[model samples]
Target: MAKIPATIVTGFLGAGKTTLIRHMLSNAKGRRIALIINEFGDLGVDGDLLKGCGDATCTDDDIMELSNGCICCTVAEDFVPTMEKLLARDLPPDHIVIETSGLALPQPLVRAFNWPGLSTRVTVDGVVTVVDGKAVSEGRFAVDVAAVDRQRRADENLDHETPLSELFDDQIACADMIVVNKSDLMESEEADHLAAVLKADARRGVQVIRTAMGALPVEILLGQKIGAEADLGARHEVHHHHHHDDDGDHTHEDEHDHDHHHDHDDFESFVVTMGEIADPTAFAERVADTIRQHDILRLKGFAAVTGKPLRLTLQAVGPRIETYFDKPHAGPRETRLVVIGQAGLDRAAISAALTA
Candidate 1:
């Protein structure tokens, strides 16, 4: 039997990973695709959104959610068994797509493929990293360009980095391909420049494609045949240091304590639920205001609207909100969203404000 090819989709929060996967499943071209989605928060909002996509190639049964924790941290307990079950199916899928948590590091998850049973059955087709072009353009991750230019004129070596930038760099370093998504929010020249900068930073021969709304064809995204796991030595990690035993079990060696969950100590996420919303526009504005007020990084979920048949989907990245009705209300007439941001979030105040 031929080994199954699995594509790993990774990126920061709100980088449009779900959107890109939806596009791939919609245009799967008669191929059966199985999805393994990992989410940061308690609620599985990403899985819920993708399930409503109504793509035949990727039905609800084909979608598996690992909301317990980050996939990398729970590989032994969550991921390995999931893959074994899928591979044991009477009619296994033609391809598998794993969407890592936005806060996840792809290297560890990629390394999981080398485990005993999975090693012979599956090959990593590619690791695609999605970049938020709009956020990058606004200097959300890296140091300010103006400050860098000033230091350069002073003949000073720039050596400033943020936690978010370190995470972004790790993602870029392990990627087989990088997609600069949401380019529509940027000027044509600015988008091209961003892509150029990313390409320069990335490993040799990696393609950086700029896109709006995560729009990319299936051919361009898949079929890389990279077998990334076999070349793990080439991909460097900025945040984690791991050593594997002879049995293939891996352990982390870092400054943080033994608890690996603390790797993301800088970030946190929580869910907010409320009754039906009266006005969609006003509700979105309220949500946006709450985001701005709380310094929330990413907020997304569905809202049950008054006198509306379809469910309202709201997604906000840094106070820039987008809302639209996706499908009809399925189970309940209530609003639910997952709020993510840096640690020390004012959850009590945010919940009160959004539900108000």
Candidate 2:
């Protein structure tokens, strides 16, 4: 039997990983695609969004959510079983797409494909890393290579590495293709320069594509045939060192360290649910204000508007907030949004402000 090709979509928080995946699913063109969505928050907002996408190729049964933890850390407990069930299906999907949590390290998850049973059944088609073009232009993740090198030279003992940068580097290093999304927010020259810098730093032959609203043809996103798992050695990880046990399974030295990088101690997330929103526009403004006040990284959820029949979808990344009525209200009418940020968020204050 031919191995099923799987694409791993990875990016930092609000980098448009879910948007890209939803676009791909919408344009599947009769292809049977299954989605395995991994989220960092308490609520499965991404999964819920994709499920409600109304794509024929992606139904409720076709989508699976591993919200217990980051996919990389829970591979054995969550991912493996999920893959097993999919492989066991009589009518398996034509392609499998795994959306990694924004904070996840793709190296660990990619390496998991080489495990005993999975290796023979599913091959990694490619690893796609989505970069927020606007965020990069604004120095959000601070991926500037030249600046970092200069800072390192200035101070021998200066460890300028933050958890965000390390996570971003790991995702970029493992990718076969990098998608610079939200290009509409960037100027032509600015986007070009960012792409040039990313291409120069990435492995040879890796392509960087710029897009707006996560819009990209399904052809360009899939069919890489890279089989990335076999070339794991070339995909360097910035935050982890691997060691193999006698059983030939790989383990990480960082897992034993006191400050394990994958533990996500540097970040936190919580969901705030409230009654119906009287004014969608005003509510979005309030959410944006609260995010800025609390330094929240990403916030997204559905809201039931006072008079509107459709459920309002709001997503805030940084200070930019996007809100639209996606579909009709399905369940109880309420407003719920997941707030994510660096550790030590003022949750009580944030929740009160959003609900107010």
Candidate 3:
């Protein structure tokens, strides 16, 4: 009974996890792969984006979605059943990949592979953590990168970790490989510095690679054969006791008074659909203005441009926006983008700006 190899992809919001997964699927090279996506919002934007990749391996049946809650918190009710179904398939996939929500902790999810029913059927090949290079360079997760670096160097035990920093650290500390995504957004030196910082935070001998648009060789991602399920202790050092029990009633928030769900309430997401834009540049300018006005963290989706046969892809990480023609629209040409940011975002005003 050869066990199916599974890879866990975890990272913060807007870290390019889906991009990497899509790339892997498109270049699977004859390997039948199944994906499990755990989305933070009910919109299922990530799952929808992957499905539009137009790859045979990315069929709706193969790509499962668990949107009710994070897999780490609902492993018993959500993850177990999903894995069971995939494994029980008459023609089971050659590999499985689990993409966790930005706010998820990978350690807990990886531990779920140790369950009695799944332990023998599937093995955790590796935990790949995708980090936003630009975000790290800009100190998005930390209050002060230099000061934190100094404090960490000065006294390893006398460090104060913010909730965001804690989550970032836990993800990095548990990664078998750290991918500094969006490297092209930063300078060579900037990417190098972030990579160095991540290398130090990760477990000893963990590989750190920089990639643009989550591009990397498929061989580098799969076939690691690390058996992460058994090596969790050595790889996942931080937040060891944060995982909940099999009873399924308790959550990470309950264990640490963390309130991840309530904390995430600080962020809000809304979709805006409009007629085709005549000018992609002008529309992007308007989107940038709205983001600046409301401090929007991420905005992405596809837009239909006037007279263009292909759909225009739209993505914004803070004020930096990236646009390109992805593929032809399947149906009516319309500009649909989802705006995500901190709570109290002026949805009406932002919608007005897009329409204006």
lDDT per model vs. reference: 0.75, 0.74, 0.74
TM-score of 2: 0.62
Query: Where does the lowest 10-residue lDDT sum fall in candidate 1?
Result: 246-255
Candidate 3: residue pairs that collide:
none
88: Cα error in model 2, Å: 0.7
Q: lDDT of candidate 1?
A: 0.75
Q: Per-residue lDDT tens digits of candidate 1, residues 1-356? A: 78899999987666778778877887788889999987553356777777887878878889997765556657788999999999999999999999886556788888999999999999998899987787787888422334322332332221223245676788899998888877767898998799889979988767677766565666557666778999998887865422321011111111111212112333578999999989898999899889877767568899999899999998765566778889998898999999976567999999999988
TM-score of each: 0.62, 0.62, 0.62
Model 2 agreement with the true structure over 19-94: per-residue lDDT tens digits: 7787788889788999997754335777777898887998998999776655555678989999989999999999
